[model samples]
Structures are given as C-alpha cells and as structure tokens.
Target chain A: MERIPILRMGDVLLVSIQVDMHDRLAQTLQEELAERVVKDRARGVLIDISVLEIVDSFIGRLLGRIASISRILDAETVIVGMQPAVSITLVELGISLDGVRTALNVERGMELLASSISLRTQE
Target chain B: MGLESNSKLVEVLGEKGRVSLNDWKEAQWAAIKIRREPITEEELYREASDFMSLFQQAVKEAFLSDIRDPVWLKMREMLSALSISRARRGFTPTEMATFVLSFKQPLFEALKQAHGTDSGALLSDVWMTTVLLDKLGLYCVEEYQKTREAIISRQQKDLLELSTPVVQLWPGVLTLPLIGTLDSERTQLVMERLLQKIVDTGSQIAIIDITGVPTVDTLVAQHLMKTIAAAHLMGAECFLSGISPQIAQTVVHLGVKFGDIVTKATLADAFGLALKRIGLVVIKKSGE
Candidate 1:
C-alpha cells in the first residue's frame, strides 16, 4: 500500500507525483488530498507531475475531479510540470482538464496559486 | 542448349575479347553521342572495360537464364553501382539500359564469326545472349528507378524539416512560422517540434504565424486547433496569427471553431500581446 506524500507549504498543499500512478494509487491520492486540504485549511493545491511518463483518460478524469474537489473546498488547484508527451497524449485523448489552472513548473505554479489566492482574498 | 550456348558465349567473349570490347565501346560512344549525355570518352572506356570483364567472368560461372544467381552477384553489384551513379549523373532509364544492351551488337558479331555455317548453334547462342543482356539491362533500369525514388524521399524529408521552424521571439515567448499547406503529417511534425521547443525553452507563450500558408479549410483549422490544444495542455497559451481576410471569411463560412484560442490578424499584433502577457512593453525613445 504505497501512498504519494502531500506536503504543506504555508497555506498551499504540494503533491509531486514521482511514481507511475495506477487506479488504486490515484484513488488513494484523491481521498488523502481531500482529507489533507480540509485538515490543513489549505488555500491552494499545486501538483508536480514532471516525472510522470504515461497518462490515460482515467488519470485525466482524476485530475479534473481533483480540481473540482479542491474548488469546492475553497482552494485553487494548479497542475504543473507536465511532460510534453503527456500533455500531447492528454490533448489527443480529448481531455482538456477544463477548470484546472496549469503552470510550466512548480515555481510558476506557486506564483499562480499565490496570485489567485491573493486575488480571491481581495475580492 | 542452355549450358552449350553459355559455354560458346563465354568462349567467343574470351577469344575475340579485344575486337568485341572495341566494338562494344564504339556502340556505347555512338549511343552517348546521339543522347548528348555528358560522359567523357575515358570514363566511358573505363566503365565499359570493367563491365566487360565482370560480365565475362559471371557468364563463365553462372547460369545464363538467371542473373539473380549468387554466382552473378558480382555482375549485379557492378551494374547496381553503375546505374546508381548514372542515375545521379542524370542519365535517363533508356540511356542506362542502352549502356548494357549496346554490348549485344559486338558479342553477336563474335558469335557469328565463331559459329559460321552453323545456324542451329548460332540461333541458341544469340537467344541466350539477348535474354542475359535484356535481364541485365532491365536490372540497371530498376536500380536507376530505385535511386531516383531514394533521392525523391530524401528531398521530401528535407522539405518537411525546412518548412516548420520554431523560433524564440522573447525569453518566455516562441513563434512557429509555418509555410506550405497543413496536412496531417506536416501538422504532426509542427506539433512535435513546437512542443519540444516549448519544453526546451520553457516558453509560456507560443505564437503560430500562418501567413505563408496558402489556404485555410476545415481540415487545416482542425489541425491548428489540435496543435493549440496540445500547447495548452503543456500550460503554454497559443495565439494564432496571420489570418488574412480570405482565410477569415473561409473559416467563418466553413463553420470551423477556434474556441477560446486567441486569433490575431498579424504576427506583430500577436507578438505585442505575447510581450504584454509576459509583462513587457516596448517604449519608443522620444529624444531619438
């Protein structure tokens, strides 16, 4: 039962997926991320998937689901560091991952989350 | 008749070698002169002499009916090399075939001299000679065609590479100036190169300039959208630039949707937007 670790930086939760995600692992991650977001009172979720080589429609849907769940929890989700091949595959698979903000890398993702959070707080 | 004709052919080739080789060279010179092929006399002499020796050796050893026999491998290899070079030198298929077929006249003359007053033997020998030389001539033509095809495909690949060039417009912006029509294959290449460049340069904004593209139909629009979608997935915003009036009218008439992707009339406009997205602006110097 391997679990992907979710770390908290300030009010943001960072999940760097370094392993090939399976259905079970994705499901576990979804449950864990939801629980942690509520427990930590996080305002943003940044996911780094630079090491992920393959992604299918299921994983694409999972990303969309995670974004939706975070949005409902009053947090922003920014998926970052997606490989070129994976991005092309996702596009070809017709999964645009709508409603999920994305960035080139973790630093950009953090900036995106910070601005978005600041913008929301001001509103 | 098979083995006997082959032996007689070999014998004539060996006995009157000098006379027949000279006759063969004369016939080749006449053909080259008629075609105005830019082949030097010395080069022609050397190639014909080399071919004669190889042909004599192969005929002495191999089955006359089959040029593809392992014993005739040397002859085939020599002709392949000859045809490929001639093909590169702009020799037509007929000219290449004639280069081999011209040997027939000289060899037939030698056969007539050897089998004088023997019609039956002369007939079979001539038949064997025609079959062998025709097979070899055809082999040369085939090799010529193959060389031409190889050259054509190489140029095609070069054209594909040349047409799609992704350039960095700024530190965080890139532009792909696409030339030629967008087909599925070219689109795939453009997408791959643009995406790889995006990853390599870490550019957040990509502007695809389609000014050089001649037409915009539904299929082209679909391909452009796919590329934009792929870029979007990589977290880089793509701006479509260089939409002429005709292309815009055609796109609207065809009902092709670009969705939320930004479309600009010119690359300069797109560059301006891109620079703005990256928080940069060009201010003209008032003093100058």
Candidate 2:
C-alpha cells in the first residue's frame, strides 16, 4: 500500500496503487495515470492495483474515461498484478475489470513492461 | 392576449347567436398558422388569442390542454405514425376519404348490425356520430403518441441498457462501463453486443473497463470468456480494465478463471497496452 504515484524505468510508467479504489480515487488515478502516461509521450503504461481491495462506481467510470484519453494519446496501458481475492470480489460485485484486459501477476506484468520498452526501442 | 378574459366565450356566442359554433372558425385558423412552411410563433400566438376569444377561460384552458395548439407538430407526428401503420395494413387515405363522403350506407348498415346487441345501451348514451368519432380519433392519436415515445425510449435503453444508459456518444466507439450487479441477462447482452460491435466497426480492440464492478460470479466469468472469444473470432481484441480487489475475491471464491487474456488496472493502461502490442508510440523527435 505504499502510495508510489510513478515508477519510471526507462520508457515505461508503472503506477502503484496504495488504497481501496473508490470514486474520487478513481478520478485521481485517471488524472495522475494520464499525466504520467502522457509524459512518456505515448510509450506505455503499467498500472499495479495490487493494494486496491475494492473499486466502486466512481473508480470504474473514471477508469473507462482514462482509457478513452489513453487512446487519444496513442499510448498503451497494461494492468498487472491483480489479487485473486480482489478479482473474485469484483466479479461477485458485478465489477468489469476483466473486460479491460487479462490479469497478470506482478512478475508477468513487469516482464510485459520490460518487453514493451524493448519493443518500442526496436520500433 | 386581449381575449384572455372570462366573458369572451359568452360575448362571441352572443355575437354569432349560434349554439353549435364549437368548430366555428379561428380553431382552423390557429391550426393553419401552426402548419405554415416557416412557422411564425408570433402568428401562432395571435391565432391562439383569437381562438381563445371564442371560449370561456375554463373552456379555453381545457381546449389548450386538449388540442395543444399550435398543433402542427403534434398533428404531423400523429398522422405520420398513422401513415406508417396504415402502410402495414394496406389502408390508403383515398379509401378513407371516399368512405367518409359516402357515409350513409355504411352508417345505416353499421347501426342495423349493432342494433341487436349492446347497441341499445350504447345508443342511449350516444348523440352525433361525427362528434363521437372525432373524440374517439383523438383518443387513438394520444395512444399512438404514447406508443411512439415508449418505442423510442426502449430503443435507447436497448442500446446502452447495462451500465449507465449508454448513449451513442461518438461516431466510432459505443461504450458501456458496468458498475453494479452483472446478472445472467446483462452478461449475455453485453457479450452479444460487444461481439456485434467488433463485426460492425472492424475494430481491432474492444475495451471492457470494469473498475467499478463489485463482484463476479461463475456465470459472469463465463459471460466474459464467451465475449472475449467472440471478439477474437471477429478479428477484434477485448480489453478488461479496472481490476479491483473485491472482484478478485469473488472470482477466486467462485473458483472461476480465465486464461491468457489482456487486462489492465485502468482503461488508460489497457489502451497503452493495446498500443504497445501494436507497436505504436506517442513520442516526438525535433524541437518546435
């Protein structure tokens, strides 16, 4: 739950989550996430929401809005390291995180991030 | 504005000295004013004032509420709706007007046919057929208006039914961000439409951002799987966004799992991921 806003390694921006995601937090995430991702100037985004145990309506819509902005910026965002318990709770609660992308462990997420950085370099 | 007096109805009736001048004159004038090519609100208001001058304030209020002048839009809307239905029924306007013109034979036959049954009681209450039919037609028009409104609302609801009443929003992307309970029907619908959208748009990616989703059951997980699978077949990739902790708990508790699908914490991250997969960058080179 360390509220690390930005974790930059070369070109990729890894955003670390530190609290349960309610609406206001979700809005902040979009703004902060957008700011960081834009700074990469369209490289990639890696968001780590492992510490967030719950997400409510505000956070969910804000996430969608943020994704829309990312598309406009021509960048990529990869969510990594979702807790199994959190995933199940969100599903039961009728949450739609899975509709965003495939859930990867932190290790896999970092690997994907590293690979994307390399891929961008190659491009 | 001047005729908005209570004594206007008595005065006009007194001037004309006619008991049956209800459909007299200016009602038609006001209706015509409403239908002009470039409708003038000022003219309409003037016609309405004249029309109201022929009625008592109470009657004027009732008539205004009933007829809703300037009636151009309302009348046009009702007639157009009737025309659509009439097309289905193979009924033509020419036939109706012709029947009205030669109303004698039909009326006599209708009365004779109805005389033996409940027509006795109905006849006791009835007076003039012309007035009765006009009132009945008014009722029919009102009913049609209600139905049309309902259908339009249903269409909108059908489009963005699940998450939060999704509107077409933009030209390309049709988005529904779900927040509360994913029952079986909603899941099925979301899956079905998302698949159809892939076919419709030829979009390579469909993002399902679910940061607000509180829980996921086995069926909901299955619903997601089917949708993603369909999207892939249609040459589109689906993005699962907003993986909250509560959802994780439900997925695990239900013991349902998906294999090797793309996911992100936020939609922005998901979009970023999609971009990266396609090898697209947002960087610039030279100084401006």
Q: lDDT of all the models against the reference?
A: 0.90, 0.52
Docking class of 1: medium
Stretches > 4 Å off in candidate 2: A1-123, B1-138, B150-206, B212-220, B233-237, B249-255, B275-288
- Native contacts conserved, per model: 0.62, 0.00
Model 1: CA > 4 A from native: B5-7, B17-19, B34-36
Docking class of 2: incorrect
Candidate 1 lDDT over residue span B76-178, tens digit each: 9989999999999999898999998888888888888878888888888888889989999999999999999999999999999899999998999999999
TM-score between candidate 2 and the true structure: 0.32
TM-score of chain A of each: 0.98, 0.71
Q: List the residue pairs that clash in candidate 1.
A: none
